[model samples]
Target: MPAKVGAVKVNNVGNSSVFNIGDVYSMSPESTAKTYAGGGSFITGDGIRIRLGQSTTYVTDKDKLDQNIT
Candidate 1:
């Protein structure tokens, strides 16, 4: 099983003006001391869904925004 390294929360309702449909985001832990990796997901109020892994590239539609952590 993958270890739980960190947690993330996406707040679209709080900043709806800056967020849009199909927007994607990713997050990871700050420390690399642990051998296992971590990831998370969330669905925004605008029907935008985001899925993330430890080390993966984020892609989205042309009209959407993509944010990821290296």
Candidate 2:
């Protein structure tokens, strides 16, 4: 029952208790809302894959991408 507004969720495809997973909505899985598919560019759901947007690399002591996320 931990629902968050404007929270992005991956579809619980196989979960018998899952709601929806292809877009964005203002309410929780039980509420009436639509998914946000970047016009066939992105998909969110369990087992479903998506190409994430380009990542930005900041200058660290090393040239590797920062692994520490807050």
Candidate 3:
């Protein structure tokens, strides 16, 4: 038996992927997490408070974007 798909709609796809009806031979996935924050509370005067935001860099391999699968 084979997979039967109807009215398939792909909205968005990101990073390296193997989207199809088949089996994958090999795949290497890597992922990591790092956070940085200022030691302070969410209490401030009636004004815009300056705070440091957390961010992460996406992994890339030469040209293609590596899929950081967990």
Candidate 4:
């Protein structure tokens, strides 16, 4: 599974990320490709980086969808 950035803290994303404590970010699945939100920057623990609120970014699509269908 890919790294699913969810309702997690920015600091938790990367041990040394600029994402401050209490900074909530919108996360998207691997399918959509990009995942960022309203104007922010985040760095992964391993250095993978992404910026929030950038056009063409997929972070704006933050909504709980049901993947498990009966």
TM-score of 3: 0.27
| All candidates: CA RMSD (Å) | 21.9, 17.1, 9.7, 17.6
- Give each model a TM-score: 0.14, 0.15, 0.27, 0.14
Tens digit per residue, CA lDDT, model 4, 23-57: 34663333323344443344347756555444554
Which residue ranges in model 1 land beyond 4 Å of their true spot?
A: 1-45, 55-70
lDDT scores in order: 0.42, 0.47, 0.55, 0.44
3 or 4: which has the higher TM-score? 3
Top TM-score hit: 3
Q: Which pairs of residues have clashing backbones in candidate 1?
A: none
Quote model 4's TM-score.
Answer: 0.14
Model 4: number of backbone collisions: 1
Q: Write the per-residue lDDT of candidate 1 for residues 1-70, one digit (tens) a residue.
A: 4345455556544422343334337533342221332343333377565554355535435754345335
Measured with C-alpha atoms, the lDDT of residue 38 in candidate 3 is: 45
Ranking under lDDT, best-scoring first? 3, 2, 4, 1
- Count the clashes in each prediction: 0, 5, 0, 1
> For residues 1-70, what per-residue lDDT tens digits would candidate 2 score against the true structure?
4445576766446532455544555643332333333443454577875555664444345644334333
| Tens digit per residue, CA lDDT, model 3, 9-64 | 78776664546644556767555554444444444778766555864554444754
List where candidate 4 sits over 4 angstroms from the true fold.
1-45, 54-70
List the candidate 3 regions with Cα displacement exceeding 4 Å.
15-30, 40-70
